[model samples]
Target: MKVVIVGAGIGGLTLALFLHKAKISCEVFEAAPAIRPLGAGLNLLPHATTAFSELELLDRLLERGVETSEVHFYTHHGQFVDGEPRGRFAGYDVPQISIHRADLHEVLLSAARERLGDEAVRLGRVCRSVEQDPERVRVNFADPSGAALPSEEGSVVIACDGIHSVVRKQFHPDDSAPIDHGTTCFRGVTRWKPFLDGATMAYVGTYDTGKLVVYPIRNSIDAEGKQLINWVIEVKKPNDGVRDWNRQVSIEACIEPFVDWRFEWLDIASMLRATDEVLQYPMVDRNPLPFWTRGRVTLLGDAAHPMLPRGSNGAAQAILDARLLAELLATKEPLIALKEYEATRLPATADIVLTNRNRSPDEILRIVEERTGGQPFEQISDVISRGELDEWQSRYKRVAGFERERLPQ
Candidate 1:
């Protein structure tokens, strides 16, 4: 059976690789005339790493990405809140990778092109719609000029399109527009001297006012030992702006919130000012649809489950979805496989969506922020008990399908 996949971003390419490995015939349709590495850093948690390892691309990813040793939490004052060894350090078999979104995309895209052939990924093809009957599925696309282009037929079609997916619209046309998180995030990558362990994922401050999440995506350049640091500034607000991922943000608007964030280990204020470019994205997600599969077409990645970017599950869940869909298709009938895929994942991801909305790992900071009345205490232990913090972290892990005791083997 032949399959057609829409969108050539991370999810689409990953799906193509999985299909190729399973000996399933498929083609990828990407809207961009050319795929260039775009966007900021993305975390590939262990579960997702498991999928990449199956595709034989882990070594290449390790070469291009930073293997994060620990994920640490901090207050606006830079005081340590909590730190945990991630990936193998945390006892998971796979190591967590902090990679440039572009680097990860390129690695997957190159592998897909090499294995599936240049014709496998049809660029300059914008998928406008898909139609499926009992016997076959047809996909329609337009060129960059907005002129109608030829349509292709396949046994099935999967939409891996990013957040604003047209196919998802066809499935849930009556769904209210995606709800905004009431927080606008400004992100950028800058070449700067390393901070902390040089491979730390750090989240600081509170979003009630402003918060910063910073990490190193690349180790060094020019032999100066300067690392590529990716940082995001999220602020609570009635944000009004375009929702485009590539939207440029004025450094002044978001930087002001962190100006007073002076700390001993790193001058948070200075780092914010050093950024060369800043991109703004409003944290927005739609209510989870009751289903993602209908007839011969199914949805994966952001198309199926778009959630808040917090907790690093955006790409991880997409990777998991691709692998699970491939597994189901390999073992079951296509239509039944789609339903089984949804049965296993839809509720699972819905938990992630709501968990991200309420109690993510960062909730520890929220607890500290409120319990201490946003003031520093002589000892963090006095502010919040270790048990409480561990509980908060554990709960999120369970919902994200990574609880310490229950992680998949």
Candidate 2:
């Protein structure tokens, strides 16, 4: 059976690789004229790393990314709240990889091309719509300039086109509006000396005040022995309702809120000042849909569920979707596989979507902030107990489907 996959992002490319491994033919179509090394850093939890491990790409990913050892949490005052082990350090078999999005995309793209052939991915083809019958599924595409392209026919069509997916809109037109959470995120990368073991993912402050997520994506880039540190600052603000990922903004506006976020360990103000470019994104997500499959077409990744970019599950869940759907398509009939994929993933990711709206792993910092009234405490135990911290972490992991015992051995 042949598959026609839309969008050449992480999910689509990974799906192509999985399908190729299963000896099932597939082609990927991307809207962009070319795939450039864009985007900042993101973490691949053990669950995601496990999938890559199966594909034998985990070691190569490790070469380009940092193996996250631990995660540290703090308040806006720089007061230490709690810390926990991650990936293999947390006893999981695979290590959590914190890498630049571009590096990860390049790895998947190169693999897909090498295995599926260079012509496997068609660039500059925007999916205009999809039509299907019992015998086959057809996908219509247009160039970036709105010129029509020859339609491709396959056994089934999978939409991995992401948040503004055209297929998703055609299927669920009325309910495609994004829900804004009144939070604006500013993200950037800086070449600087690492702090806190050089591999720690640090979370400082709460969203109500100022939330900063800091981690190293690449290590030892220059003669100064500096690592490429990725940082994100989230603050409660009015969103202009634009969802462009490449929206560039002045760093001064992002720095003003955290001007005094100077800590003995790492100076947040200096790091922001060092960044050459900063991208702004509004924290938005679509409410979960009732279903993801319609006849011979099914949605994957962001096209299936666009959850708030918390808990780092946006990419991880998408990778999981691609793996499962590819496996099912390889074994089951195309239509049956589409339904089963939705049945298994829709509800699971739905819970995560709703959970990410409020309660995520970072909820620990929010809880401590609430309990301590955002003040610096002499003893962290005096505010919240260790048991409470563990509970919060475990709850989020379960919801995000990355609990150690639940992951594949």
Candidate 3:
């Protein structure tokens, strides 16, 4: 099947790689004039890493990123809540890799070029709409000046355009603007010495108040033995400003609430202040669509379901979507393949969207904060048992399709 993929993101690039692997004809179109690495760091769980393992890109990702050894949760007061091993340390065959979004994007971009050829990716093509007949689906594009460009034709089109997807909008024309869940995330990267074990990922505080998730994305980028740490500050707001990911705000405004985030393990306030740039994004998501596949067009990644970003499944689920869609399309007829892709992934990702909305692994800190009444406890066991904490983590894992037991030995 000849496939046209909209949005050359992690999901789109992944789909491109898989299509090439299957020797299926496909092309990737991106809106941006140039694909620069954007956004912060993200965790690659085993389920997501499995895609990399199959593609033989796992080692390259780990070489540039930190192999997450453990995950730690702490209260806003800096008291420990609970900790657990991750990646191979958790006994999963694949290691959970943590890396900057830009680095990961570049890796995927480079691989796509090498495997699919340089001319495979068409940049400066912003998809405005799509139309499909019985034979082929075509996407209308616009140039940088908003001038209409020639429409591209393919057997099918997959929208990976993210939350602001134009293809998705064309399908669900009246769909209301993205529903804001009252949370705003301020994210940035800072160079600092390792706090806990060098490869640990930490989630401190609670989202209702002020939550901080910090982890090292790159190791030893500077001469002073400092690792590039990615941190996020999330706070519940009655009203949020713009929802753009690259929206810049005063660094002081971003770190104002985190000013008192001082801890023995790491000085949160200092780290927040040390960052050169801070980008703000509203924690927003759309309700699951009734179906992702409509005729010969479909949605993937944030376009299909933009879940709350707390659960660390944003990119993971997208990667999985690409893998599955390519698998089905490589076998079934174009139209039937789109339907089968939706049947397999729609319900699965929808569940994760709701799960992340209600109670995600990130809420482990919120749970402890509630039990302790937002105060430090003599013992973490006093606030909550280890079983409860383990349940929180495992339950989300199961929903995200990465539960250790669910995998084959």
Error of 2 at 299 (Å): 0.2
Question: Which candidate tops TM-score?
Answer: 2
The global Cα lDDT (0 to 1) of model 3 is: 0.88
lDDT tens string, model 2, 1-409? 8899999999999899989988999999999998888889999999899999989999889999999999999888988888889999999999999999999999999988888899999999999999988899999989999999999999999999999989999999898578888888889999999887999999988877789999999999998889999998888886788888888999987777688888988998988899998999757899999888999999999998998888899999999999999899988988999999999999999999999988988878888888888778889999999999989988999988999999889
lDDT of each: 0.86, 0.91, 0.88
- Model 2: CA > 4 A from native: none
What digit string (tens of lDDT, one per residue) describes model 3 on residues 1-409? 6899999998999999999998999999999999777898998999989888888899889988999999998888887788889989999999999999998998899999999999999999999899989998999999878999999999999999999998888888888788887777788988999888889999988765588899999998878889999998878763364777788777877576678888989999988888988988768889999877889999999999998887789999999999988899888988889899999999999999999887888787777777878777998888888888888888888899998887644
TM-score for every candidate vs. truth? Answer: 0.97, 0.99, 0.97
Candidate No. with top lDDT: 2
lDDT of 3 at 71: 92
Give per-residue lDDT, candidate 2, residue 190.
96
**Location of the lowest summed lDDT over 10 successive residues in candidate 1:** 400-409
